[model samples]
Target: MAKEATLQVRMDADLKEKAEALYRDMGTSFAEAVRIFAKQSVQENGMPFAMTANRKNTYGRLSGYANTKLAAEEDGAYEREMVGKHEKTD
Candidate 1:
Protein backbone atom coordinates (compact mmCIF):
# COMPACT_ATOMS: atom_id res chain seq x y z
CA MET A 1 0.00 0.00 0.00
CA ALA A 2 1.22 3.54 -0.70
CA LYS A 3 1.91 5.81 2.26
CA GLU A 4 -0.83 8.37 2.76
CA ALA A 5 0.00 12.06 2.91
CA THR A 6 -2.02 14.80 4.54
CA LEU A 7 -3.17 17.71 2.39
CA GLN A 8 -4.35 20.87 4.12
CA VAL A 9 -6.33 23.59 2.41
CA ARG A 10 -7.88 26.84 3.62
CA MET A 11 -11.26 28.10 2.52
CA ASP A 12 -14.07 30.25 3.82
CA ALA A 13 -15.84 28.57 6.74
CA ASP A 14 -19.26 28.73 5.04
CA LEU A 15 -17.88 27.34 1.81
CA LYS A 16 -16.22 24.48 3.65
CA GLU A 17 -19.42 23.67 5.54
CA LYS A 18 -21.49 23.78 2.36
CA ALA A 19 -19.04 21.56 0.48
CA GLU A 20 -18.99 19.07 3.34
CA ALA A 21 -22.77 18.91 3.36
CA LEU A 22 -22.87 18.50 -0.43
CA TYR A 23 -20.43 15.59 -0.34
CA ARG A 24 -22.18 14.07 2.65
CA ASP A 25 -25.46 14.05 0.71
CA MET A 26 -23.63 12.18 -2.06
CA GLY A 27 -22.59 9.49 0.47
CA THR A 28 -18.97 10.68 0.57
CA SER A 29 -16.85 13.05 2.59
CA PHE A 30 -15.27 16.22 1.26
CA ALA A 31 -11.84 14.69 1.86
CA GLU A 32 -12.71 11.70 -0.31
CA ALA A 33 -14.08 13.98 -3.02
CA VAL A 34 -10.78 15.87 -3.00
CA ARG A 35 -8.89 12.60 -3.26
CA ILE A 36 -10.97 11.55 -6.29
CA PHE A 37 -10.30 14.94 -7.87
CA ALA A 38 -6.56 14.56 -7.31
CA LYS A 39 -6.48 11.07 -8.79
CA GLN A 40 -8.48 12.19 -11.85
CA SER A 41 -6.20 15.21 -12.31
CA VAL A 42 -3.14 12.95 -12.32
CA GLN A 43 -4.74 10.63 -14.87
CA GLU A 44 -5.70 13.57 -17.10
CA ASN A 45 -2.21 15.16 -16.82
CA GLY A 46 -3.82 18.43 -15.66
CA MET A 47 -7.03 19.80 -14.14
CA PRO A 48 -9.99 17.42 -14.56
CA PHE A 49 -12.14 20.29 -15.78
CA ALA A 50 -11.59 23.36 -17.92
CA MET A 51 -10.47 26.49 -16.03
CA THR A 52 -11.97 29.69 -17.34
CA ALA A 53 -12.11 33.25 -16.09
CA ASN A 54 -15.50 34.55 -14.91
CA ARG A 55 -16.49 36.70 -17.86
CA LYS A 56 -19.27 38.45 -15.93
CA ASN A 57 -16.82 39.68 -13.31
CA THR A 58 -13.97 40.33 -15.77
CA TYR A 59 -16.07 42.35 -18.24
CA GLY A 60 -18.55 43.93 -15.78
CA ARG A 61 -21.44 45.41 -17.82
CA LEU A 62 -20.57 43.27 -20.84
CA SER A 63 -22.62 40.51 -19.19
CA GLY A 64 -25.71 42.33 -20.51
CA TYR A 65 -24.59 41.54 -24.04
CA ALA A 66 -24.38 37.87 -23.12
CA ASN A 67 -28.23 37.78 -23.00
CA THR A 68 -28.27 38.02 -26.81
CA LYS A 69 -26.75 34.54 -27.17
CA LEU A 70 -24.90 31.89 -25.24
CA ALA A 71 -22.26 33.14 -22.84
CA ALA A 72 -19.74 31.05 -24.82
CA GLU A 73 -20.53 33.07 -27.94
CA GLU A 74 -19.78 36.29 -26.04
CA ASP A 75 -16.52 34.84 -24.78
CA GLY A 76 -15.59 33.79 -28.33
CA ALA A 77 -16.37 37.27 -29.67
CA TYR A 78 -14.24 38.82 -26.94
CA GLU A 79 -11.34 36.52 -27.78
CA ARG A 80 -11.61 37.30 -31.49
CA GLU A 81 -11.74 41.04 -30.80
CA MET A 82 -8.61 40.81 -28.69
CA VAL A 83 -6.79 38.86 -31.41
CA GLY A 84 -7.87 41.35 -34.07
CA LYS A 85 -6.61 44.31 -32.01
CA HIS A 86 -3.25 42.61 -31.54
CA GLU A 87 -3.01 41.84 -35.24
CA LYS A 88 -3.72 45.46 -36.20
CA THR A 89 -0.92 46.71 -33.90
CA ASP A 90 1.62 44.23 -35.25
Candidate 2:
Protein backbone atom coordinates (compact mmCIF):
# COMPACT_ATOMS: atom_id res chain seq x y z
CA MET A 1 0.00 0.00 0.00
CA ALA A 2 1.13 3.59 -0.72
CA LYS A 3 1.46 6.21 2.00
CA GLU A 4 -1.37 8.72 2.21
CA ALA A 5 -0.83 12.47 2.04
CA THR A 6 -3.03 15.36 3.04
CA LEU A 7 -3.42 18.53 1.04
CA GLN A 8 -5.05 21.81 1.97
CA VAL A 9 -6.23 24.53 -0.36
CA ARG A 10 -7.70 27.99 0.18
CA MET A 11 -10.26 29.21 -2.34
CA ASP A 12 -12.52 32.24 -2.66
CA ALA A 13 -16.25 32.14 -1.98
CA ASP A 14 -17.27 32.39 -5.62
CA LEU A 15 -14.83 29.68 -6.65
CA LYS A 16 -15.93 27.42 -3.81
CA GLU A 17 -19.53 27.98 -4.77
CA LYS A 18 -18.81 27.09 -8.39
CA ALA A 19 -16.97 23.93 -7.43
CA GLU A 20 -19.64 22.84 -4.96
CA ALA A 21 -22.36 23.59 -7.48
CA LEU A 22 -20.61 21.50 -10.10
CA TYR A 23 -20.16 18.68 -7.64
CA ARG A 24 -23.81 18.81 -6.60
CA ASP A 25 -24.80 18.73 -10.23
CA MET A 26 -22.72 15.56 -10.49
CA GLY A 27 -24.24 14.13 -7.27
CA THR A 28 -21.07 14.45 -5.22
CA SER A 29 -20.02 15.88 -1.85
CA PHE A 30 -16.99 17.95 -1.00
CA ALA A 31 -15.09 15.11 0.65
CA GLU A 32 -15.83 12.82 -2.25
CA ALA A 33 -14.63 15.62 -4.49
CA VAL A 34 -11.31 15.73 -2.66
CA ARG A 35 -10.95 11.99 -2.90
CA ILE A 36 -11.54 12.18 -6.63
CA PHE A 37 -8.84 14.79 -6.95
CA ALA A 38 -6.42 12.71 -4.87
CA LYS A 39 -7.04 9.72 -7.11
CA GLN A 40 -6.42 11.77 -10.22
CA SER A 41 -3.32 13.38 -8.74
CA VAL A 42 -1.90 10.03 -7.83
CA GLN A 43 -2.65 8.71 -11.33
CA GLU A 44 -1.29 11.69 -13.24
CA ASN A 45 1.29 14.26 -12.22
CA GLY A 46 -1.47 16.69 -11.16
CA MET A 47 -5.22 17.18 -11.25
CA PRO A 48 -6.69 18.05 -14.65
CA PHE A 49 -8.37 21.43 -14.78
CA ALA A 50 -8.43 24.64 -16.69
CA MET A 51 -6.59 27.24 -14.64
CA THR A 52 -7.90 30.34 -16.39
CA ALA A 53 -9.54 31.58 -19.53
CA ASN A 54 -9.25 34.89 -21.34
CA ARG A 55 -12.70 36.55 -21.35
CA LYS A 56 -12.06 39.78 -23.18
CA ASN A 57 -15.01 41.26 -25.11
CA THR A 58 -17.48 38.77 -23.67
CA TYR A 59 -20.93 40.40 -23.74
CA GLY A 60 -22.81 41.01 -20.48
CA ARG A 61 -19.91 39.72 -18.45
CA LEU A 62 -17.94 40.54 -15.31
CA SER A 63 -14.98 41.67 -17.43
CA GLY A 64 -17.07 44.56 -18.69
CA TYR A 65 -17.90 45.54 -15.13
CA ALA A 66 -14.20 45.48 -14.23
CA ASN A 67 -13.33 47.72 -17.16
CA THR A 68 -16.07 50.21 -16.33
CA LYS A 69 -14.98 50.29 -12.69
CA LEU A 70 -11.35 51.01 -13.60
CA ALA A 71 -12.36 53.88 -15.85
CA ALA A 72 -14.56 55.33 -13.10
CA GLU A 73 -11.68 55.16 -10.65
CA GLU A 74 -9.42 57.05 -13.03
CA ASP A 75 -12.06 59.74 -13.57
CA GLY A 76 -12.52 60.08 -9.79
CA ALA A 77 -8.76 60.51 -9.31
CA TYR A 78 -8.69 63.24 -11.95
CA GLU A 79 -11.59 65.05 -10.25
CA ARG A 80 -9.80 64.90 -6.91
CA GLU A 81 -6.67 66.39 -8.45
CA MET A 82 -8.66 69.25 -9.99
CA VAL A 83 -10.38 70.00 -6.70
CA GLY A 84 -7.03 70.06 -4.85
CA LYS A 85 -5.64 72.54 -7.35
CA HIS A 86 -8.69 74.87 -6.99
CA GLU A 87 -8.54 74.89 -3.15
CA LYS A 88 -8.01 78.23 -1.36
CA THR A 89 -4.27 78.77 -0.78
CA ASP A 90 -4.78 81.13 2.19
Candidate 3:
Protein backbone atom coordinates (compact mmCIF):
# COMPACT_ATOMS: atom_id res chain seq x y z
CA MET A 1 0.00 0.00 0.00
CA ALA A 2 1.18 3.49 -0.80
CA LYS A 3 1.60 6.01 1.99
CA GLU A 4 -1.13 8.63 2.14
CA ALA A 5 -0.54 12.38 2.24
CA THR A 6 -3.01 14.71 3.95
CA LEU A 7 -4.03 17.96 2.35
CA GLN A 8 -5.99 20.81 3.94
CA VAL A 9 -8.07 23.01 1.69
CA ARG A 10 -10.34 25.96 2.44
CA MET A 11 -13.44 26.26 0.30
CA ASP A 12 -16.58 28.35 0.17
CA ALA A 13 -19.37 27.01 2.45
CA ASP A 14 -21.99 26.94 -0.32
CA LEU A 15 -19.66 25.28 -2.81
CA LYS A 16 -18.58 22.76 -0.16
CA GLU A 17 -22.23 21.88 0.51
CA LYS A 18 -22.91 21.46 -3.19
CA ALA A 19 -19.84 19.27 -3.68
CA GLU A 20 -20.74 17.13 -0.65
CA ALA A 21 -24.33 16.72 -1.90
CA LEU A 22 -23.16 15.73 -5.36
CA TYR A 23 -20.60 13.31 -3.95
CA ARG A 24 -23.25 11.71 -1.72
CA ASP A 25 -25.58 11.32 -4.72
CA MET A 26 -22.77 9.51 -6.51
CA GLY A 27 -22.19 7.31 -3.41
CA THR A 28 -18.74 8.79 -2.82
CA SER A 29 -17.08 10.94 -0.19
CA PHE A 30 -15.39 14.32 -0.64
CA ALA A 31 -12.11 12.70 0.34
CA GLU A 32 -12.59 10.16 -2.45
CA ALA A 33 -13.09 12.98 -4.89
CA VAL A 34 -9.84 14.61 -3.74
CA ARG A 35 -7.99 11.32 -4.01
CA ILE A 36 -9.31 10.67 -7.51
CA PHE A 37 -8.27 14.18 -8.55
CA ALA A 38 -4.83 13.73 -7.07
CA LYS A 39 -4.39 10.40 -8.82
CA GLN A 40 -5.42 11.90 -12.14
CA SER A 41 -3.12 14.86 -11.65
CA VAL A 42 -0.25 12.49 -11.02
CA GLN A 43 -1.04 10.33 -14.05
CA GLU A 44 -1.70 13.24 -16.37
CA ASN A 45 0.31 16.46 -16.22
CA GLY A 46 -2.85 18.50 -15.82
CA MET A 47 -6.22 18.41 -14.05
CA PRO A 48 -8.78 15.85 -15.19
CA PHE A 49 -11.73 18.21 -14.80
CA ALA A 50 -12.60 21.86 -14.82
CA MET A 51 -12.32 22.89 -11.17
CA THR A 52 -12.80 26.60 -11.80
CA ALA A 53 -16.25 26.93 -10.24
CA ASN A 54 -15.62 30.59 -9.47
CA ARG A 55 -14.69 31.45 -13.06
CA LYS A 56 -17.44 34.03 -13.47
CA ASN A 57 -16.72 35.68 -10.12
CA THR A 58 -12.98 35.65 -10.72
CA TYR A 59 -13.27 36.88 -14.30
CA GLY A 60 -15.95 39.50 -13.46
CA ARG A 61 -17.34 41.23 -16.58
CA LEU A 62 -14.80 39.48 -18.82
CA SER A 63 -16.44 36.15 -18.04
CA GLY A 64 -19.78 37.12 -19.59
CA TYR A 65 -18.06 38.90 -22.44
CA ALA A 66 -15.84 35.90 -23.19
CA ASN A 67 -18.73 33.45 -23.29
CA THR A 68 -20.31 35.04 -26.35
CA LYS A 69 -19.64 33.55 -29.78
CA LEU A 70 -18.33 36.86 -31.13
CA ALA A 71 -15.94 37.20 -28.19
CA ALA A 72 -14.71 33.64 -28.71
CA GLU A 73 -13.99 34.28 -32.34
CA GLU A 74 -12.19 37.50 -31.49
CA ASP A 75 -10.18 35.81 -28.76
CA GLY A 76 -9.11 33.05 -31.12
CA ALA A 77 -8.07 35.60 -33.71
CA TYR A 78 -6.07 37.55 -31.11
CA GLU A 79 -4.34 34.44 -29.84
CA ARG A 80 -3.38 33.28 -33.32
CA GLU A 81 -2.03 36.73 -34.17
CA MET A 82 0.04 36.88 -30.96
CA VAL A 83 1.49 33.36 -31.29
CA GLY A 84 5.08 33.20 -32.71
CA LYS A 85 5.10 37.02 -32.78
CA HIS A 86 8.17 37.30 -30.55
CA GLU A 87 10.50 34.47 -31.54
CA LYS A 88 14.14 34.91 -30.57
CA THR A 89 16.82 34.73 -33.31
CA ASP A 90 19.80 33.41 -31.39
Candidate 4:
Protein backbone atom coordinates (compact mmCIF):
# COMPACT_ATOMS: atom_id res chain seq x y z
CA MET A 1 0.00 0.00 0.00
CA ALA A 2 1.17 3.52 -0.71
CA LYS A 3 0.99 6.34 1.75
CA GLU A 4 -1.20 9.29 0.96
CA ALA A 5 -0.68 12.93 1.83
CA THR A 6 -3.18 15.67 2.48
CA LEU A 7 -3.13 19.05 0.83
CA GLN A 8 -4.69 22.16 2.28
CA VAL A 9 -5.41 25.35 0.42
CA ARG A 10 -7.10 28.58 1.32
CA MET A 11 -9.13 30.48 -1.25
CA ASP A 12 -12.08 32.81 -1.48
CA ALA A 13 -15.38 31.09 -0.77
CA ASP A 14 -16.99 32.29 -3.96
CA LEU A 15 -14.04 31.19 -6.06
CA LYS A 16 -14.02 27.79 -4.40
CA GLU A 17 -17.73 27.32 -5.00
CA LYS A 18 -17.41 28.35 -8.63
CA ALA A 19 -14.48 26.01 -9.23
CA GLU A 20 -16.28 23.14 -7.57
CA ALA A 21 -19.33 23.69 -9.75
CA LEU A 22 -17.19 23.91 -12.86
CA TYR A 23 -15.40 20.65 -12.10
CA ARG A 24 -18.64 18.92 -11.13
CA ASP A 25 -20.12 19.87 -14.48
CA MET A 26 -17.08 18.27 -16.11
CA GLY A 27 -17.81 14.97 -14.29
CA THR A 28 -15.08 15.35 -11.71
CA SER A 29 -14.58 16.96 -8.34
CA PHE A 30 -12.25 19.86 -7.74
CA ALA A 31 -9.93 17.57 -5.75
CA GLU A 32 -9.71 15.19 -8.69
CA ALA A 33 -8.94 18.10 -10.99
CA VAL A 34 -6.13 19.12 -8.70
CA ARG A 35 -4.77 15.58 -8.72
CA ILE A 36 -4.92 15.53 -12.50
CA PHE A 37 -3.03 18.78 -12.59
CA ALA A 38 -0.35 17.41 -10.27
CA LYS A 39 0.03 14.21 -12.29
CA GLN A 40 0.27 16.14 -15.54
CA SER A 41 2.81 18.52 -14.09
CA VAL A 42 4.91 15.57 -12.95
CA GLN A 43 4.74 13.97 -16.38
CA GLU A 44 5.63 17.25 -18.10
CA ASN A 45 8.43 18.00 -15.61
CA GLY A 46 6.89 21.44 -15.13
CA MET A 47 3.62 23.29 -15.64
CA PRO A 48 1.38 21.50 -18.13
CA PHE A 49 0.27 24.83 -19.55
CA ALA A 50 1.88 27.83 -21.14
CA MET A 51 1.80 31.18 -19.35
CA THR A 52 1.85 34.57 -21.01
CA ALA A 53 1.54 38.09 -19.74
CA ASN A 54 -1.54 40.09 -20.78
CA ARG A 55 -0.04 42.40 -23.41
CA LYS A 56 -2.67 45.09 -22.92
CA ASN A 57 -2.09 45.18 -19.21
CA THR A 58 1.66 44.88 -19.44
CA TYR A 59 2.49 47.27 -22.28
CA GLY A 60 -0.42 48.85 -24.09
CA ARG A 61 -0.82 51.79 -21.73
CA LEU A 62 2.89 52.40 -21.58
CA SER A 63 3.16 52.99 -25.31
CA GLY A 64 4.46 56.54 -25.88
CA TYR A 65 3.99 57.30 -22.19
CA ALA A 66 6.34 59.95 -20.85
CA ASN A 67 6.96 58.19 -17.51
CA THR A 68 7.17 54.42 -17.73
CA LYS A 69 8.46 54.24 -14.18
CA LEU A 70 5.32 55.87 -12.83
CA ALA A 71 3.16 53.65 -14.98
CA ALA A 72 4.87 50.55 -13.64
CA GLU A 73 4.49 51.81 -10.10
CA GLU A 74 0.78 52.35 -10.63
CA ASP A 75 0.41 48.86 -12.05
CA GLY A 76 2.19 47.40 -9.03
CA ALA A 77 -0.11 49.36 -6.72
CA TYR A 78 -3.19 48.12 -8.52
CA GLU A 79 -1.99 44.52 -8.36
CA ARG A 80 -1.34 44.84 -4.64
CA GLU A 81 -4.78 46.28 -4.06
CA MET A 82 -6.42 43.43 -5.96
CA VAL A 83 -4.44 40.82 -4.11
CA GLY A 84 -5.38 42.30 -0.77
CA LYS A 85 -9.02 42.43 -1.74
CA HIS A 86 -9.15 38.76 -2.81
CA GLU A 87 -6.96 37.28 -0.13
CA LYS A 88 -8.72 34.87 2.21
CA THR A 89 -9.20 35.84 5.81
CA ASP A 90 -9.63 33.43 8.68
Local accuracy of candidate 4 as per-residue lDDT tens digits, 1-89: 35399899886799799999999999999999999999999999986765334445534443543366866678778778878888855
Query: Model 4, stretches more than 4 Å misplaced?
Result: 1-3, 55-90
Compared with the true structure, what per-residue lDDT tens digits does model 2 show for residues 2-90? 54776676757897888889999999977678887777878887645433335543333444435566677787797788788889553
lDDT of 3: 0.72
Q: Write the per-residue lDDT of candidate 1 for residues 1-90, one digit (tens) a residue.
A: 574799988767998999999999999999989999999999999877664455545344444444555555677787799999999999
Candidate numbers sorted by lDDT from highest down: 1, 4, 3, 2
Per residue, candidate 3 scores C-alpha lDDT tens digits across 1-90 of 575677887767897899999999999998889888888988887766444546555445335435477665786786666664644322
lDDT of candidates 1 onward, in order? 0.79, 0.69, 0.72, 0.77
**CA RMSD of each candidate after superposition:** 11.0, 13.2, 9.7, 12.3
Over the full model, what C-alpha lDDT does candidate 4 score relative to the true structure?
Answer: 0.77
Q: What lDDT is reached at residue 3 by model 1?
A: 40
CA shift of 3, model 1, Å = 5.2
- Rank candidates, TM-score, best first: 1, 4, 3, 2
| Clash totals for all candidate models | 0, 0, 0, 0
